[model samples]
Target: MSGTIQFKQDLPPKGGYEPIRYKRNLPARGPGGLAVFGGILAICAYGFYKVGQGNLEQRELKRERAWSRIHLIPLLMAESDRDIYRREQAQLAREKELMKDVPGWEAGKSVYNNKRYNPQNFVVM
Candidate 1:
């Protein structure tokens, strides 16, 4: 007998190992990770939206201020005229009262002599 050893194969031919396949049924929001991600996204979106809204409000306020400035001259003049008219009316009323008391007293002098005409005594209300 030769000094070589030979064995007969009775088993089937061997092949490389095949990877195992498994069905994945994991939820999209597993372990709250998706929920946390969504929350972060929502926070960032809201922040951006608030910034945009603030910018819009600031722009509107600036525009209103500019508009008011442009129209302020006429409004101020009208207000001054109205104040003057009121002052004249008040003087006339004081003169009428003084005329009823003194036959020939001027209304302007009566108003000037009235203690209530003191600037300190004038209350806006």
Candidate 2:
């Protein structure tokens, strides 16, 4: 009878029971630190290379533009000088007609301010 005796509320074991989802889980290993750093460095190097190429291309374009402007300067000056010469010729003709009855005065001749006043002077931009 003593051996067969049982308590009304059966107690659990001394060690606690494990949870239901107790399967063994192994943590996944990621990429090594050196490999990750190398990948990041490669990306940065590619970005810098592209930027340098763009800067070089822009510099070439700017140089071409400056050279073109330099080449056109003489032509622009010539055209301007031609226009000024035509205007002076017209002014001289008008002055000769108007002052014909009057005495010895020239059209484009100035006693003073004559050092660089002619249309032959090359105007620079």
Best by TM-score: 2
Stretches of candidate 2 above 4 Å error? 1-7, 13-16, 19-38, 99-106, 109-114, 118-125
Residue 9, model 2: Cα distance from true site in angstroms? 3.4
What lDDT score goes with residue 112 in model 1?
Answer: 62
lDDT score of model 2? 0.79
Candidate 1's residue-wise lDDT over 1-125, tens digit each? 89588888686447855656677876665448788899999999999999999999999999999998988989898998899779777766865765777766665543365566433334222
CA lDDT for candidate 1: 0.74
Worst 10 residues of 1 by lDDT: 116-125
Most lDDT-accurate candidate: 2
Rate residue 103 of model 1 by lDDT: 66
Evaluate residue 52 in candidate 1 and report its C-alpha lDDT on the 0 to 100 scale: 100
Question: Where is model 2 poorest over a 10-residue stretch in terms of lDDT?
Answer: 116-125
lDDT scores for all predictions?
0.74, 0.79
